[model samples]
Target: MQRYFIAPEQFGEHTVMIDGEDAHHLLKVMRMKAGDEIIVCDGLGKSARAKLTLLQAGQAEADITEWLGASAEPLWKVTVAQSLPKGDKLETVIQKGTEVGAAAFIPFQSDRSIVQYDGKKEEKRRQRWSKIAKEAAEQAHREIIPHIGEVHSWKQLLQRMAEFDLVLFCYEKEGGAAGSGIADAARSFHRSRGESQEASILLVVGPEGGFTSQEAEQALAGGAQLAGLGKRILRTETAALVGLTCLMYESNEMGGA
Candidate 1:
């Protein structure tokens, strides 16, 4: 059965309407017929199994055959507060980050970040990232789309770091510290959360050149524990995905995929 996300408002008693682009895809692209089965989700974790009752121009009606509760969301909520990288990097970050179940993405300008964003450019950046997140979520079969928060300065990032329960700032300083790295930090914190407990993880990854000493120290002072990804360095785009995958896998929450 095909799966599509719809707004909670569109879900009604016994009947549901899926119109617009989705309808067009179902009717034409996917060649869905009247009796075809489809699953509709609210993108906020509610879902229903429906059989197509009617198909028309910009409209596809169905009956609610069954309801699926919030069964698709990740057990851990992760927020990636990444330093703004060079051109096209942010798009990759948002798209892959969404696939890994990040709840939010924070783009910030750090000391080593060469890319500067003025007010106007910053708004456009957010919009583009938002689009990438939406498409990634749909393709990954995610029930909720991760939010792309506005670009921030180092000061603003520190101010917001206190919000998450466990905040981790990827720092090379941990390279010198024995037995304390990103993998270690992630396991140390994630292990404390019993299965089914509601917890949030905030992982901060810097730009192409990585975080400066001052920025890393400040992030630590602001409540984020510092950790190094590993001995071999990674690119800005690679670091986010690598670090996140390690975190999810270590926690056994990647769910066999």
Candidate 2:
């Protein structure tokens, strides 16, 4: 079934009103009419099965049939704090990261980042990134769409480190060393959770040139654990996904073999 993320207010006692882009996609693009069943999510984790009762140009309505219980979200909320990379690599990260169970994304400027920050076009770029996340979430059957944060400077990103329960800094220098791996970190995080089932994690990936020693030291001082992906060096765009996948696997969000 096709899934659509609707606002909470748009949902009635047992009905949901789909409008604007979603409606157009359902009514015209998908050619969905009355009696077609679709899944509706609030993007805040609530979702339900609905049968379309009305379909018109730019508007559609569906009667809720069953509230979904299973969720595609990870037990721990993993936010990807990615440094600006060259070209459109950030877009690829956002799209694939969302599918890999990232709860949010924070794009920041690092010391060795090749792309310079452009404040004038940030909003437009953010909108495009958000759209990519949303589409990826829908395709992956995620209960919530991953959030895209505004571009942050190195200092700004460091200041927000305290917000997360754990921060894993992906540094190339840690490869093949005795440093912490994402699984061990995730396991430690899970053990320390005590009564809480949910925890927030910030996975920081550097740019193409990777994080400098000074930056890595600063991150360690800011309460981040330096971790490695594997023996092979990964592109800046691939690090976030790999780290996120490892975290998910360790948390048992990924199915057992």
Candidate 3:
């Protein structure tokens, strides 16, 4: 069934109200009518099955048939602090990263970063990235939409490192280090959190040209482990998704057969 994410206030005791763009999609694009069943998510991880009860003036209301279960969010949370890459790579990162269960994405300024944004341009870019994240979440059947953080300065990125229980820097130079592979690091994080109830991870990926030695050193000194993706170097766009996939797999979010 089609799923629509709405705020808590949109839902009454027995009915769910959907307005704005979603209503337009249902009424004008989907040509949905009364009695059609659709899934409604509260965006806080709650979902429900509802049947359309009314459609008027670009607004749609549905009667709640059943309240669904909690989210499919991973046992662990991952926030990717990616250095802004050239072109539309950031959008790709947000799109694929969301599918792989990343809890949030933060674009950061790195010494080697090629793209720069500020003022109105930055706001517009953020809006575009957020839209991509939301669409990807819906497509992937994710219970919660991954957050797209604002463009962060180098200082801000460093400051945010303290918030996570574990931090990893995807450094190509560390690829040959035994036991420091992305999968290994992720497994270690998972094991460390196994005894606990919740854990948050911060994975940092450099920009297109990669991080400078000084930058990597600073990150390492700030309690970030240099986790290697593989022997071969990966493009900036590919790194975050690969890291997120390894994390999700290690956390058992991607069921292993």
Candidate 4:
């Protein structure tokens, strides 16, 4: 069944209203007609089986058949704090990171970041990034679309670090030696959680040039545990996905017993 995320307000007790781009995609692109089945999610971890009951220009409606079970979201909420890289790399990170179970994304300006933040196009850029995350989540069968944060300054990123239970700084210099690996950090976080499953994590990945020594020191001082993906160095875009995947795997979200 094709999956589409609708706002919570758009979902009635027994039916969901699909409008705008989604409606066009359903009625025109997919040629879905009345009686066609689809899954509708609220982008808040709630999903349901829905049967299309109405289809018209720029609008569609589906009747809820049955509510879904637990979502595909990871038990541990991981947010990727990625430094802005050159070109459209951040889009890739957000897209793949959503598939890997990252709860959110925070794009920051690092000292070594080649691409500087442009206030003039901030809104447009953010909207594009958010759309990527939403589509990726739907394609991956994720009930929740990852939230994309505004581009933060280095200091702002550091300040936001205090919000998470665990902050993993992916430093290339650590490379399997300088800091605890993802598995160890995840296990320790799991143990620390005790009976609660509401833990949140922040994984920081630097830009093309990676983090400078001073930046690394500042992160370390901010209570971030330095983490190494492995001995090999990964591109800025690859690091967030790799780290997220490792964390999800360790958390047993990847079907490990």
Candidate 5:
């Protein structure tokens, strides 16, 4: 059965109204008809098995059959704070990061960032990344679509670091240090969580050229713990996905429902 995410308001007592792009996809692209079975999610960690009942007037309606409570979200919240990379690398990061269980993405400008997002281009890039995240979340059956934060400057990034409980800075030079690996840092954060308090982690990855010593110093000064991914140096695009995947796995996200 195909899956679609609908607004919470669209879900009534027994039926869900599907409209907009989802409706168009059903009516035109998928050629779905009445009696077809599909999964509809409310995008707030609620999903149900729905059977198509009506398709008309640029909309589709489905009756909820069974509610599914199983969630794929991790116990801990992770936000990928990625520095701007060249071309479409950041897009790839948002797409795959969503699939791997990142709660949000924050693109920041670093000292070594080769690409800069100015006025018109910034808005366009934000929209593009938001769309990519939405599509990726839908395809991956994620309960919530990961938020794409606005691009931030160096100072803004540092200021925003106060929001997360823990921040893991993926530093290339720090991988050789003892207990500086992502697993070690994640374990520490996971252990520090109190009753019913989920750990919120901000995993920071630098740009194509990586962060300068001064930039790394600032991030470390802003309460970010240096974490090395591995011995091998990964590209700017690979770092976020790898970091998120590892962190999720370490937090037992893969083992959970």
Candidate 6:
């Protein structure tokens, strides 16, 4: 069955009127008939099977049917505070990170960051990134779209560390006893019961060149654990995915695959 996205408000009165772009896709591109069945996700926690009851130029309605599923979300809220990288990599980071169940993505201006945005440019960039996150969530069959937070200064990133229960910094520059082995740390974080140090995992990843010693030190001093992902260094985009994947594995979302 074909699947489309709609807001929760469209679900009352035993019918949902598919409007805007979704109606355009159904009528023009797909040429769907009145009896055709399609699934609509509310992007909250509800998905339903419905057949087209009416199809018109200005209106398209689907009749009520059985629900496909309910409540698809992760256990914890994982937010990624990443230093904005150059090029189109930010789009990829937002998309893939959404797929792995990251609850939020914050673009931070850091010392080593190459690209910079301010005022109007920053707002436009954020709008585009939010759209990418929405599309990724629907593609991945996620129940809710991950949030794209406003771009903040590196100092803001350091100050906000206290809000999250677990703050982990993936900085390869930091070495020694402060480090926690990847797999074991993930296991420990996953197994944490009630209110452990990792009840709310907030991961921090740097830009293309990685975090400077000063930035890493500041974050560590602000209660962020400088955890090593592996021996080799990864690009800004690759590092986000790696960190998100590690969080998923640690949170037991990998599902034995």
lDDT tens per residue, model 6, 83-197: 8888899899899999888888998988988988667788888889988987788778877778788998998988899998878888775432333645555566555554323
Worst window of 10 by summed lDDT in candidate 3: 189-198
Ranking by lDDT: 2, 4, 5, 3, 1, 6
Name the regions of candidate 6 deviating beyond 4 angstroms: 68-70, 174-179, 194-199
Clashing pairs in 6: none
Using lDDT as the measure, which candidate wins?
A: 2
Better of 2 and 4 by lDDT: 2
Clashes of 5: 0
C-alpha lDDT (0 to 100) for residue 191 of candidate 1: 65
Evaluated against the true structure, the overall lDDT of model 4 is 0.89
Minimal lDDT window, size 10, model 4? 175-184
- In terms of lDDT, the poorest run of 10 residues in model 5 is 189-198
Candidate 4 local lDDT, 1-257, one digit each (tens): 79999999999999999999999999889999999999999999899999999999999998999999876677789999999988889899999898888999999998998997899999999999999999999999998999999999999999999999999999888777633677677777776776438778999999999999999999999999888778898888888888888888767787754
RMSD of each: 2.2, 1.7, 1.5, 1.5, 2.1, 2.8
Off by over 4 Å in 3: none
- Return the TM-score for each candidate structure: 0.91, 0.95, 0.95, 0.96, 0.93, 0.88
Better of 1 and 2 by TM-score: 2
Q: Assess the local accuracy of residue 39 in candidate 5 as a C-alpha lDDT between 0 and 100.
A: 91
